[model samples]
Target: MAGVLLSAAVACVLLAGAASASSSSPRVFTVGGVERGWRQPAPGEETYNHWATKNRFHVGDFLHFRYDKNDSVLVVTRDDYKRCGADRPVLRLEGGEARFRLERSGFLYFISGSPGHCDAGQRFTLRVMAQRDNGAASPTEAPAMSPGGSFNSTPGSGSGSTRMPPRGNAGDGKTSGAAPFGAYHAVGAALGVGAALLAFAPPLPATISDPPSTAASFPAASPMASRLRLGQPNPNPGLSPSPGERKGEEGEARKPEPRREVTDLGGGSEVVHIPRFMSRETAWEMFEHLDKRIPWTRPTIRVFGRSVVQPRDTCYVADKGLTDLRYSGHQPHAHSWDDFPVLKDILKEVHEALPGSHFNSLLLNRYKGGSDYVSWHADDEPLYGPTPEIASVTFGCEREFLLRKKPTNTKSQAAGESGETARKRLKASAPQQHSFLLKHGSLLVMRGYTQRDWQHAVPKRARAASTRINLTFRRVLP
Candidate 1:
């Protein structure tokens, strides 16, 4: 009994000492405009930062929104990120301020949910100070920083003293008119001549006339130089052009109907109705041709102690042709300038038949659709350049094309004609996939804003009607 009593007494003393130490330490800290050297929270973003030092904030810490030229503040975070405990704290601006208690801890991020504000770069962070006592006071005092340190809300809003040096620089933000670092500046005369040549180079094939026959003429050359010189109306005008000659002149400018008809799908979508777009016979022929070549092999990648098989393939490359037609479970076919001969022929033929588009490169997707499918993804590869045009041709079994808009916030939905709200619009100008029966011999063109704002997929079919082959034409980086 004596030993037990003594042990209890000592334990009590240790506990008391710990409690005393915690009570004396400062637990509460404040974060706001005072800490973030800014006049307002990034013009339109909701700033973020903790009120305590380190990861120590707990329930009851107050968050404040300062007065600024702007009206209100909104906090936003991705649904997945939020569920993962990395979302920004949810707080609102009303009357003069808003507050939120730190109920939990982990990595958290946030942004202003205002009109295009977050897209403008309004972001911040907060690392709560470790808690020493549960009785820590609320965030009521102003944050402290050394002299020369201050907040600038619009610069980059948040509850931290992250500052930017005066005299705007590339590091401060994106530079507007500065030339590239280490740019090649040629000799004065040589550079001047080169610039002039580039500026005045012919915009298209020489066969094309200066002014287009329609109102949408390619604005080639200066408008003044290309203006038609019309002789004075009646002063000495000869008898009005004979009927035959008059009709000839008018017919010269009248656009010809596309030899290949286009099936107008309701809702502004249309498909090239060329007879050879695809057919059962063509699909079987392509399969036979591919079967004679080497089969595709899957490429493997190791990640986190596991081997990840990427789209892979195995092909025999010869000066003349490839001998393999198999899915390699990889993407982006290996093509080079050497392939230009055949490619040029293909482009020439297409150009002669359909004069509205031009092809620069070819991207081959070997989907030996034996047992796999590509997940939903956007092909925004930069090499394609901005507003790149693409053509997709399919050979073999028919399959469904699945396309969906990039999901976004409801409040930020884009408005379109008919005043309908759309999360995404088809490059064809409608918010739907213009599905085609991409049969053998069929070709589909994804031009205009396709890559700029939409995504596409060729999902794996449970009972694939039949094995299919797809080829996509693109303009690789020059």
Candidate 2:
């Protein structure tokens, strides 16, 4: 009985210690200190590197950036950091007074996203030291400002001096902690903790390294510069069993389904073809629902000096708050997305299949027969932003989708040529073209710089064809 009581007391003491350690406050460091804010370093003045080297940053510590709204922050790769390039940043933060927590135990790079700021010494590289066994605080605790303008620190802790630096025009000197740091925190905390605890953890050197090769995991395709080759066979074909069908019926041999296939188009362009993305029955049901229920319109555009009606019927559906979309001289008003539940469900499925791609608007096209088709053009509207991922879902008849590479020097070469002459030259010098027969119940995704380099169209077919409906999901930026 005495021994049992002693063990219980020891367990209680350990629990108390763990609770106390977990409550420790994360240290917050001002990016350029209180005097300078996030300005460029003066000649021979202490830069961010100088200040960072003076302190010991742990996984849970926060780096607070206070700057003007015009300036921005970019979390970039090591190569981008060295060149001060802002393109393709790993992460970007705009506005003033952003807080980034150091969640991993390796090197992290940051730079000013504003033009010329990075060149003027407004960048920093931080190395987070490995965490110790002294139970670190959870990454979720919101950083609240205390009366002394410092982050709230635990009572009787010596790290209380880490406070917000004074600013002349800073608003409220407080943060709501509403930033989307959850993803960063989770990734960092898991990696940091796991690396520290595991004896067989891979050696994480504190230097920039090349990205791991994904070639072994993915197949290769032809290297045609200006042509789209026929897409390869589906790697993992067939309909995945529905959730209800996946449950136990032990020892039942499941038939293999046709797999989705991805084809590389070079220049960071690719197409993902998903065979039978939806079951045949579901696809037909959706096609019938959209065809009968949608309020389709025949929009007109000025082509060849005449106001010609479009060849195909179209409808625009968008989220409730999005502005009307205008493309190719047609300003189409968007229908409320709530009116289309089937499309919303389809969009959800597309989102699940393609991670990181989010769609806010869908442009639906109805090709009544072989005669209805669209001309050559790229969906490169400014509203879609710089580079957009378009998820196109096809239902009904199969049609040949053609792609032709745009002339690289069209503008420069036509500088002195007449408009007609320039157009003729471009047609004569057009690069190799490619085509794909988009099947019913399949999906095609166009990614990367495809819009800037390629133009696509569905040419009219010579023979009679069944009605086809296409839903091209897009993200319209505010």
Top candidate by lDDT: 2
TM-score (all chains, Cα) for each model: 0.34, 0.44
lDDT of each: 0.40, 0.65
Kindly list the per-residue Cα lDDT of model 2 for residues 1-478, writing each as its tens digit: 5455444444443443343333234567777776687876654354565566545565456777777768877777667876889987765656566665553345577888889888776787765543422433333444644443343334433222233223221244323222123433543454444444333333323322211111010012232310132121322211233333332344332324447788777888777788778755356546655776678999898787788899999999898777678766788888876776667778988997788998999999999999999999898888887778998999999888888787566767877898799999877776768777888898988888788778889999976378999999999898
Scored by TM-score, the top model is: 2
Error of 2 at 389 (Å): 0.1
lDDT of 1 by residue, 1-478 (tens): 5455444444443343343333223223334445552223332122232122123443223344553435344433334222322234344333323333232222234444444433333333332222423443443532322233222233234423222122222254522112222221222333344334434442222121111111110112222332222112222222232233323332321113333645444433334544364333323333433433324455674445666775423332222242222322333345443433333433554555556665555544455664555555655677666666566666666666665554444443344422333433423344455445555666666555556556777776666645565655655445
- At residue 472, what lDDT does model 1 achieve? 59
RMSD of 1: 34.8
